[model samples]
Structures are given as C-alpha cells and as structure tokens.
Target chain A: MDEAAVSSLAARLADAGITRLGRSLAVRHVDAGSCGGCEISLAGAVALRAGLTRYGITLVDDPREADVLLITGVVTTTMADAVTRTLGAMAPPRFVVAVGDCAVDGGVFKGAPTVLGGAERIVPVDLLIAGCPPSPGRIIAGLVALLEANAAPVAAARRSSRIEPHA
Target chain B: MNPALDVAIASAAPPGTAVMLDAATWRSLAAGDARLGFVGLFVSGGRVHALFTDGSAPLLLATELIANAYPSIATGFPQAAWFERLAFDQTGATAEGATDRRPAIAQGAAGTDAAWPRFIETAGEGFYQIGAGPVAGRIASPVHRRFSMGRFSMGRFSMGCFSTDDTRILRLEHRLGYAHRGIAGLMRGKSPRVAARFAARIAGDATVAHAVAFARAAEAASGAVAPPRAVALRAIMVAVERMTADLAALAAAVAAAGDARFATLLGQAREQSAVALGEAFGHRLMMDIVVPGGLALDLRGDAVASLLAALDRASLVVRAFAWGRVRRDLGPAAGIAQARARSIRALAASVRADLAVVPEGIIAAALPAGTGTALGAAESARGMVYHWIDLLDGQIRDCVAIDPSARLLPALEAGVVGLDPQAAAVLIACYGLSVGAIDG
Candidate 1:
C-alpha cells in the first residue's frame, strides 16, 4: 500500500536474484477446466495488480521458451492433449508448477471419468501450490519459493506441495 | 446523440461480407427498454458490437425463453447456438429448433441424459459420432478417455491427455466426453474457498478472469476495493496469460499448417512466458492471484523492474517474428487473406445470438428475449465462458458457468459447415478454445 513497502519488496526480490535478468525460466500454463475463477485471479496478478513483467520475468508464448509450466483448473479428458502437446513443445530443464489444487490434484473434477486431476498425470510437476487458486500474493510467494528452490544448490530440495491425496 | 453513434448506426455494415442487420436497425430491433429481454446494445465502429444488461431474477423462465428462441437467433446471429446450449446446460433451457442438445455438465451418471455437442445431421447412426472414452474409471481408463462413435476415435495418452491413432488423420466433427464432472453440484454447498477451485475449472486461462469477476461481484456486494498494488499485479498476470495463450494458438495454427519451424518458435515463446510466470508469481500460471476485494499478493519495486526488463527482452522476441507472414489473416481478415487484427473489443463483442452459448470475457450479460438473470463471459485461455450466478440473500443459490471451448466445439462442427476441415480447425483455434476450458 505504501511506496516504502514496495521499494523494500523490490530490494528483497533483487537480493534473491528473482528478477528477469538473472532468471532464465520458462512457463507453460495449463487450464484443467476451471470456472475462470482462478484465471480471473491470475488475471489480477498480471493485468490489474502485480505486473510480472516488472520483475524481468515474463510468460513465454511458446512452450520452448518455458522453463516452468504453470497449470490451473481440473484436467479434463478433452484438454489432455492440449496440455501434453504444450509440454511436448517445451525443451528440457522444464518445471511444471500446478497452481491450484485442481492441477496439483484434480479438485472437483477428480474421480469423475471425464475429470483428470493434477497436471502430473500428463507431465512431471516440479512444484505444487495450495488453494483453489492461491492469492496473487500467495501465487507469487509460491513462484518465488520455486525460484528460490530452483536457484538453490543442486542438492537443495524444492518446495513440495502440502495438498493431501485425493479423497 | 454522438455523431459516432449515428455514423455507426448508418454504416452498421460489415466490410466485405453483407452484415445480417444494420447497427441502428439492430439496436432498435433488439431494444429491450426495460432491460427485460436483453440490455446493452453495444456496437463498435460500424460493426455491430456486443450487448449487455443487468438481468432480473426468476431466471428459469427467462432462460426458457432464450432456450426456445436460440435457433431463431441462430438464423440471425449464428453465434447464438453456443449460448442456447449453455442456457440449456445451466438452466435446462433449450432453443426450440436447436439441433445440438449435448449437455455440457450433468449430475447423474455420465451420458444418462448427457446433451450432445450440437445436433449434427445424421439419419439413424450413419453420422460420425465420437464418444470421448472415459479418462478414468473402474471399467475403463477414465483419465485417458477417447471419443469413437464409429470409425472415428479420440484418445488420451497420459494425465488427462488426448491422443489419436497415428494412422487416423484428423477429421472435424462434434465430439463428446463419456464422462462429465458435476462441478456445479459439488459447488452447491461448499464455502467460497471450497468452491473457489471450481471457478478455475471453468476455463484454465480465464481462471483469473472468472475469479476477478467473481471477486468483483463479491467486492461490489461488500463495497470493498482491491489494493492498487494488487490490481496492478492482476493486470500483468492476465496479460501474461493472454500472451501465453495467444502464442499457443499461433503455434497450434503453425503446426496445423505444417510449419514446424514457426510452430517451434511459437511454442518456445509460450514456454518463455510460462517460465517468466513461474519465476515472478510463485505459481507459473498465477492462478488464484485475486481475492474478493483485493489481490492475493503485491508485485511492485524489483518485480516491476524485473518485469520491465523482461518486457525489454520480449520486445526483441516479439519483433523477431514476421507477424505479417505467420498470421493467416482470417476471421474477417481470413476472408480477405489480409492481416487485419480484430481488436479485443470486437472479439469480445463477437457474441452471436444463434450461438449455443456466449463466448468468453463476458463478465455479465443480459438475457435474450428480455428474460431473467443471465450472465456470460469468456475466460482468459480456454475460450469463451458463460456464467449466470444466482444469489439469494447474497448467497450463491445457483451459478452456471460455460467455457468457450464447449461453446466452440459445437461451432467448430458448424465451422466445417462449408469449409475445409483442416483450415477450419486452425481458424477455430484463433477464437481461443482449449479442451480444458470446456471440460472445466
């Protein structure tokens, strides 16, 4: 809310080397068939609120540029390929980050024959975040944590998701 | 009256193709002074734009009117088919003459009363009917569902993935999933957080769009405003999602056209964007970045600097491509084979009455035929999305959401109405529909 807080946030992120300059990351966003609710939240992060571009990190249009695949919603039978094809397009050193519980583990769409939960069933997920669609701040926190883990020494473990298995 | 309005009214004609209705006449014809049948009469720059209004209550009756009149609107708007189908799915309404009755979502066993994608012309069972095999199930691999009505079959390879027999070439037709998740039923009694994830199920890319809209709805009711910082962050997130999806759509087009090099480049672009998303926002897709009345996070200072830096890098990337060459110039431009970009406003307003449902990005819409409450929208990526949320004492009584993908699937079948199947798929992709958006 205040300029001073924003300034400090920037300093801290830079100290962590999370800006676009030092980071070479790729993102692949998947829609697991959400109600557009999570997307709207994501929209706020990009459009109305925190601009990811200012961080020097941006969303790669092509899968090849993606270092991370951002997944959302509950995976559906229909969308499976689009997700796979998107992943297939990416190069190595890719990370799949399941943003919501649906992608992490199929939320409501889980168990349904038509519903496919968690993006992992399609590709290997590097990280998983909690919440229906985590708050933009939470989303950023999750991403920052991933970046931090990715930035850590090879031996350092990444942030494992806290979501429980499908009920 | 503004001269532009008059000019738009006078010129209310589509270039190259004969517009079905003139702007002024259309406004007058569609005028529901009471905002009863439909409210806003939005037309952009001579072209008939989109219309919107605050719908009334007792939606079932209003929904029924639109259902019965969908086919008629199709005669004029052609796009209303999707809306009609959506109306049917959300409220059990239907267009009297609408051929397709494929249910988008259902409560009981899948396909018991499942609606077809849009009715296709078939005498008996001769028509190609592709049933999306269960992606997961006790009897079958439900997650790897396939669609095979006859000789045509669609399959999934892995984690909710779709795959086809290598030998089987692509053919365009109305496809259906053997399984349907009763998401609405699930959200029926859950708290917002429990039901919040279901919103993402509406459409993947539009997850933020829908969430923000819902949050705005909640916020509006609560009379709260998001922090400026949060709003800024959300906007950037949305742009990233849009750009990522746009690139994917472009890549899909290139791949469809057998342009591997361009496709690869576009794919790379999408990945690059995704990676940026992951690094900046804790989640790559940035889902759930919004909260009711404010953003879930703050993106300022270094994030801004970093974002600006990335934009600078992207400038090089965006400029690297010869858009003129890659863009096939379709959708109005497609007809001329010229590169004429459709503004978001135009694209947003492209809602057709004949459409079985509304395309995505519609936060709220007025019901057709001056009926009750009906809100429509298209999520960020998965395609056009429609939502009709009913609140009783400020509690969600019923919420109906339809991803553009579902609406587009039927349209895709219709798209092949008089064109090459392959070409149509690419063209349809431009409208922005991802299967996840449909199923979600």
Candidate 2:
C-alpha cells in the first residue's frame, strides 16, 4: 500500500474512537537495552515518507505526555527500573506496546544474566509485535491494531456511562 | 617481530596468532613502540591479551597476569584506557598503575550505586556541571554525559533555548555501558553459528559487518575457506551496509543543522535502500546472512538488479542535494555532514562495482572440526571491528568482539572539549557511537 493509503486508513481507525484520548496518539519510545535494529525500523515507520504523523500518531520524548509506551529490546537489569519508572510516570489509561522479539520474550537474549526477560517482566505490555526486529510496515500495522483493540474499552465505558443516569 | 621486544611464538599460523610474552616484556614493548597502535585488550584463561596492529598486520601479544593484575599499557596508549577498564569489569584482572581505574561496564549493572561513576569535579567560580541523558531526545541509544562548564559567554544558543550567559564546556565525560547485554557470556559454549547471532546483534546498525567479521574469525579458527561467490557476496553486503549507515549519519547531521528538507530527502533515500535490502537479503539490516563458513543463504535471483537500481536512486538523491544550500556556520556538524555525503557517494559506487562482478560457486563451505585461535577484522561503517575467537572442538571457547565504538568513545571524549553542548550533541550523532557494541 502507498503512504497516503496507510495514513488514511489509520486516520479512519483513529476517528472511530480508537483511543481514549481522542484522535491523536502520543507515543514514547523506550530503548531498554536493544540491538538498535528496532529503533532504525521505528525511525523508518515515522519518517516523512511513511507519513505516520498524518494519522495523528506522533513520537514524544516524555512519558507523561504519551498515550502509548512503545518499548524495544530485552529489559536489561540496569534499565528494568528505568522502564518501570517511565511506566509509573505515565498517566492512567496508557497502553504499553512491546516492539520486537526481544521485548516480547527476550528472544535470543533470554536467560542471559544481564537481562530481566522482556518488557512484561517490568511493565505490563498491552500489545506484542513479533520479529527479530519487526519491519516498519509490521510496526505500523501493530500500532493500528493497538488502536483498534483500545477502542473496545472506550466503547464499553461510553455505554456504561450513558446507562448510569437511567439506572 | 620487532627485535627490541622479547616474545616467543606459541603458535605458527596467521599474523594475528597469540605470541606468549612475559608481563615485563609486554609492558616494555607497549612503552617502547610508538608505531604500534593498540587495538583491543581482553582477559581469557588467566592471561591478559593485547592486540596491536603495526599498520599492515595485527600482532596478538599475551602475558600471564601476576596477582590478577598487569602493568598498565594505557600510559603509553591512551586508547587502551577504556579497554583496560572493561577487562577489569569483565574479569577481576586489574591494570595496575592505570590512571583511571574506574568501573566501565560493571557500574551499569543492577547492584551498582547511582554515585558509582564519579565525574571529575571542576570546582571554582563560574564552573558548573550539566548532565544529559541515559535517555536523550528522540530515538537514541542510552548513554549519560556529564559536561563540566566554565567561562560564561553571553547570548548563545543551547539545545533550542537562549541563555543569558551560556557557559563554555570545559570538559565532556561519557558514562557508557547502559546497554550491556552480556553478549560475550551469551556466546560461551555455543557453536560459531549460534554465537554468530549474538555477534550480529552486538550493534544492530553494523550487523552485516559484525557478522562478516565473526564469520571470518570462525573460518580462520576452523581452517575453512569461503567459496569465491560467498566472498564476492560478502563484499557487496559490506558496501551496502556502509552506504546505508552513511546515509543515516548524513541525515542526522543535516537534521542537527536545521536543514529539515534535505534531511527528509536523505531519510527517504535510506528507506528506499533498506526496502531493497530487505527484499534482497530477507532483512532490512541484512542480519544473520553471513555465517561462520560463508553466507547462510545465497542472494535472491534478481538481488543485483534491484540493489543496483536502488543505489542509482540513492546516488541521484545525494547528488541533487545542493551542498552550497547548507549553512556554513553549523559548527562541527556541517563538516561531518559533507564528509558523510562524500562517503555515501563512494560507497554507492563501490556497491555498484561489487554487484557487477559476483562469481558463480557454492555459497558456503563446511568448517573443519579442530581447535585453533585467530583474529578476524572487518571495516565497519564507523571503523575497524575485530573479533578474536578461540574454538575448541567447534565450540566457541573464548571470544571477544572489539567494536570500533570502544576507540570512538575516547576520541569523542577528547573531541567535545571546548564545544558548546548543542555542537557536542551533533558531534556525537555524527560520530555514530554505539553503546551496545562497546559494552558488548
């Protein structure tokens, strides 16, 4: 698919109340000890040609302002607390997305003394994108899926809130 | 052999074969020779080994440690400072008389205190300190920098903020090892093929280069020769990897200099090249393609054509970016950007040349079962990457992958002195310092 088509599709999904925080999603990327391959792919995913920003998805540097915590790599012991602190700093209704095989289950680095398994070992991961280093297309698709999965909770909360006054 | 050094050849193989030398002789040689450049230092099997290259071939010098300590070589070779610290951290072997005997990788471990790495204090009037990162702005590998600032200058730009009295950076010190993943420990007891995966991931950006180097090291240790076609393909992969890395570095430099349009153009070109590489080699970074004996898999049927086309497009984009359009006062970043542009152009041409001459033969050769020690070197995008492998019955007994970032870190510490914080950040990006590779 073309860049325009991908952006339009993501926008359409966002407009359907995919996130609790309206149409836009702010993502904070955490490199909890990675090989840096995922960071390169993530850069490509958000590059000008990819046009992910047009879909109201943007990368933020601060965790407090982020709606999604996108983490890459196995959570090293040195970074495990940092990852927890970053997640703790974020506001409620935040989703944690594990971006690579290493973050998913520590991949090849599993059982190494320095690593603390995966992202789930420190913070609860809402979504898992699997690849040694996932492709840019796959990463984008995973984000879209995260948004879609998030919509169900928002819809259920809306329904319950609307029925509360009558009940 | 230099006749001035007392060394006995333990094994007669390649030039990089480990030669046994006493601690006294090793110290004397390091102190005497100005021509020999210290490449790396590692501790294995109760001995400290130092690798040196005298311009043409590498020389591996080994010495038995006395009381878990060796005489300091860092006094002669400043680059050996970090390596000595790392060796101490990995093993308890200390470099006695070394000036900076601080922990390198161990400080980044779980039990280490926050106040472990004590930065040199510059206490005086108008002298202050500013600490940046373990987490930086945008996507970056984690590393902390403690900048000692002194001598304030009025009305200077620092990280997009105008300061009333911006302090000149007197010194810049880096605290690395935040990305340590126990890569050397992970490779222990594994076959070269399995260990190759660890080497490939040491620094993801230099995966192809690292993999090729590790493969060559394993081949040398096992007495196996890659077929002609595999050798040709390896050269092509290295050129492509270099081209991609150069493009990324150039884009970063341009972005730092506020040329967003040109940076975006370079990014687009890099993305196109990555796509072509992914289609051709099954990974965008081309990881795991180069194994111990040879390539794990041959190139795709039409890889050459697709890659050539992508290179042509990349070259066009690079050539079209007007050099004169860039601002001259972008400090160090501008100079590095121009250099990267030239490097990218040359790498593209080299890739084209390499792709045009891929030979026809088997893609891999079976490595013979034996015990041997050898050093393999490959020119990465940053600099020379060396892998020292000791194989025992086809298993990696002792292995050390020395990344160029180890050397670059010291150079970066030296280069950033007297520059503004903003310029230092740009210089760091342009240097392409990989903390993961260094820690590994």
- The number of the candidate with the highest TM-score is 2
TM-score, prediction 1: 0.52
What lDDT score belongs to each candidate, Candidate 1 first? 0.47, 0.81
The list of candidate 2 runs beyond 4 A from truth reads: A1-19, A148-167, B1-3, B6-13, B29-32, B108-115, B152-166, B325-329
Q: Which runs in model 1 stand beyond 4 Å of their true positions? A: A1-105, A108-167, B1-77, B93-172, B177-179, B191-194, B313-315, B323-388, B402-411
User: How do all models score by TM-score?
Assistant: 0.52, 0.90
Cα lDDT tens digits, model 2, B271-386, are 88888998898888999999988998888867667778888877887888776665363576667667777878898998888777888989999988658888998877897889
| Candidate number of the best lDDT | 2
What tens-digit string does per-residue lDDT give for candidate 1 at B87-167?
455455445555545554433354233334443444333234333322211011112222222222344433243333222
- Residue clash pairs of candidate 2: none
